[model samples]
Each structure stands twice: as C-alpha cells, then as structure tokens.
Target: MRIATGDDPFVVEILPETPSTNAVLAQRARQGAPEGLVVVTEHQTAGRGRLDRTWETPLHSALTFSVLLRPPAEQVPAERWPWLPLLAGLAVTTALREEGYAAGVKWPNDVLVAGADGDRKVCGILVERIEAATGSTSGPGPAAVVGIGINTSLTAEELPVPTATSLAIESGGLVDRTAVLRHVLRVLFEHYADWVADSESLRPAYVRASATLGREVRAELPGGGTLVGTATAVDATGRLVVTTPQGDRVVGAGDVVHLRPAR
Candidate 1:
C-alpha cells in the first residue's frame, strides 16, 4: 500500500475514490498549489479523455491520476506547451515498454500496446490549461493539469471496447499497479525535465514511438470536416501532418482514426 515517490519533486495524494483526479488538481492549482502535486485515485467515477470522451472502469482496476505543472513561460514558452500531452504519451509508452509490453503512442495522447489482432489502447491522457484567476496568489501565469488513466488489472471482457486492452490481459497475469505507477511517474518526470531544456529534442523520440506515423489515417477535424491521408509527421508545433492528394495538411486538433492500409 506504500506508493514510492522516491525523493522526486512530486507530492502524491492517494485517495480511495474520486470523480476525477484532473478536476481535483485543477481546483487545487487555482488555489495556488505548487507544481508537482499529484492526485491519484483508486476509482474514478467520471474519467475523461481528449475530445471530452468519458471512460469508466471497475474500481481498483486502473491507474487514474493527474499531475499539476506550472512550467515557466519564459523557460518553456507558451507556444511550445502544446507538446505536453504528446510528451506524456511518450513517457507512458516508455514506462510500459520497460514492463515488457510493446507500447507506442497514438498521436496526441493515447498509448497502445501491440496485440495479436492489432494495436489496443491501454492508456489515455488529457491535459488542460487553467488560466490564473484575478487577484489570485498563483500569479498571472497558467497551470496545466495532466490526467492519465491506464488499464492495469481488467480482464478481456472488462475492456470498454474491442480496441481497448489491459496490462493483465496482455501479460496473462496480474501486474503490480504500484510498480507501474512509480515507473510511469519517474519516466514522466525525466521526460518533463528534458523537455524543459530542449523542446525540439522531444519530437524525434515521439515520432519513433508513435503508432500513427507511417500509416494511413482519417482525421475528423473540428467544425464538421474531415481529412484523409497518410500521416507523415508531427510538425515543430506538435500538430499532426498528413499528406493528402491536394496537398499536405497539418491538424492541430482532431479525432484521428488509423485507417487500414490501402491495397
């Protein structure tokens, strides 16, 4: 029951249950909580993902947590902040790889593990930027709350969708949730540190760990539109670049579906 943070900058608060760790941490951030405040819950009644999708899982069967970060705008630059979710995906992918799973990022934030049928998502991430309130002691800067959910002990039948999976199913046995959580936090901290030093250095590593690159995809763009093409690269700004027949199009935000390769 002892969760080891090991002298990292993190201050972890483990709750028995909660509605959403992100919500809790965002509220705390607005109340002037320092960076590296982590909120973890054994059960999340209302977890969410990108595009406002809701996810629910059995109690104590997943890793549900959120990290509060207040990266200095002078050091990280506001424009470079879009890469936080992608960086988190890379960190999770690296951590799961060390656990003997073939994990890779599915652009923006989902982490997928290669399966016999295809790649199945084992983790999802959501990052939200909270603006500072007027006259708040937290300063005029913004804070980011990074929420992460990883399916650990769920069985095959318990998966939310056909394309979803759990570490237990992949490993054929129960995996230690605390160990997984520790490893992920360690890697995420290291990745975050490196990114603060050099943001561009993160791009190549993410591309290498990305399952979306070098594949055909359909991106459901915002405002009722779509773009289908081969996913080529993640540009300098962390947007997805796709090569369409008309020309190359860059997607800043959208629901991307990996399409089956054309014959």
Candidate 2:
C-alpha cells in the first residue's frame, strides 16, 4: 500500500523493521520527541506486550506502531493512566466495525473479533510511562507511549493460538491496512481529546465495549497473587471492579483471563 502523506495531522514514521516500536518511541520520547509522533514498523523483530511477553508480527502483514503523548503533569495520576489503553482499544474496535468486521474490546487492551465458533483476539495495546530523572520531584514524566498491534492479513496458520485470529481471516478477504490504521488513529485522537475535555462521558462507551464486565475471571496479580472473581464493572477511574470470593476488589494491574464458571 502507498503511504499517504500530509493527510493526517500526526507525523507518521514508517520503518521496514524495528526491534520494538514501543521501545523505539520511548527512547525517542526520552530524547525529547514531540507528542503525536507515531512510529510504525512493517515488522517487529522483538515486539513486547504488557508483562514483557513476546508479540510477533510477520513483515508487512499487520499494523505495528506506537503513538507518543505527553499529558499535562497535573493529570498524570494513576487513576488516569488506564484511559490510554481504553481509548486505544476503543479506536481499534471502532475501526474494525467500520470496515464491517465484528470486534469488541477484551478487557484491559486486547481486541476480540467474533469468529465462526467463538471470539478470538485480533489486536493488542500496550501503554507505558516514561519516568523522570532520579530524585527529581518535578511532577510526572515527560511522555507516554501507546503501542498497538493488529492482525490484518495473517492466515489461521500464522496465528499464535487457535483462539487468535486476524481481520482478513475473519472477513475471508484481505483488508486495507492503511484504511484501518487511519481510522484507528482518527478515532483515538478524537477520544483522547474528549478524555482531556471530560472523562465522565467516555466511561459508558468503554463499559459497553468491555468484554470482562459481568463475566467470571481469573486475574493473575503483579506479585504472584491470584484472584477469582466476577467482573462487576469498571469504575470511573478505569479500574476493574471485581467481586472476588472474599469480597469486591478493585484491580489496578493484572493479567485477566475470562473463565467459564461451573454449572
């Protein structure tokens, strides 16, 4: 596909191959790259996920990119961090549906596409914060990078798991990667702007699109703790409100897997 120029406000940097788009963008941000600069690679040799897991993408067959944003210092609290992933997921889901693919947000950041037998993960998002220098008490960091990976043309054989799929596979035809990328960026920018304006209004849409709500789940916590619960909802701050066996708990960070409860 021909790369379009001057059509979007953001600066798009396309690379043939990168170790990791997220890592590259973070390095650039540390060196003072401006917000809205997007780094995209046709292939990622060492892509990374939230917990340092591997994210593999074949050359020129998927959307692999990272967007840089530096929100104001006052708004850099933990409560607002989840908005980055939420907005990114919303953008991708909207873009897929616009292209006539059935898609939804599997809680946290995975994009689930409806398959013939069941739902499969088609996209993933990872958001990371760039911290300030040591011992510097000057508020939050300078930048945050949100990385996104979407399976566009990969066949079932290329999928990492039987529960994973691609937009092309789901549609039974090739999809326009450029079109999907454009739509996702546009949607994300719009929602990010709205989030800056008023976060309250964006909560309902996220809740509606979230796949974890009302489902039983097993969350593997950061410190090797496990919580079995039913996802009640996501609070305004974007934390998962889970009703655990002990009681209700707000999970700030964890790997969540939806579970099928016993009959």
Would you estimate the TM-scores of all the predictions? Answer: 0.93, 0.88
Candidate 1 displacement at residue 176 in angstroms: 0.7
Lowest-lDDT window of 10 residues in candidate 1?
254-263
Give candidate 2 regions above 4 Å deviation. 1-7, 74-78, 132-141, 222-224, 255-263
* Runs off by more than 4 Å, candidate 1: 1-4, 137-140, 254-263
lDDT of each: 0.87, 0.79
| Predicted structure 2, TM vs. truth | 0.88
Q: Write the per-residue lDDT of candidate 1 for residues 1-263, one digit (tens) a residue.
A: 22446698787889998889999989988888888888999999999877678877899899999999888888988999899999999999999998899999988778999978899999999999988876767464799999999999998788898888999999999889878988998899899999998989889899999999999887765565677889899998889888999999887754444333332
- Name the top TM-score candidate: 1
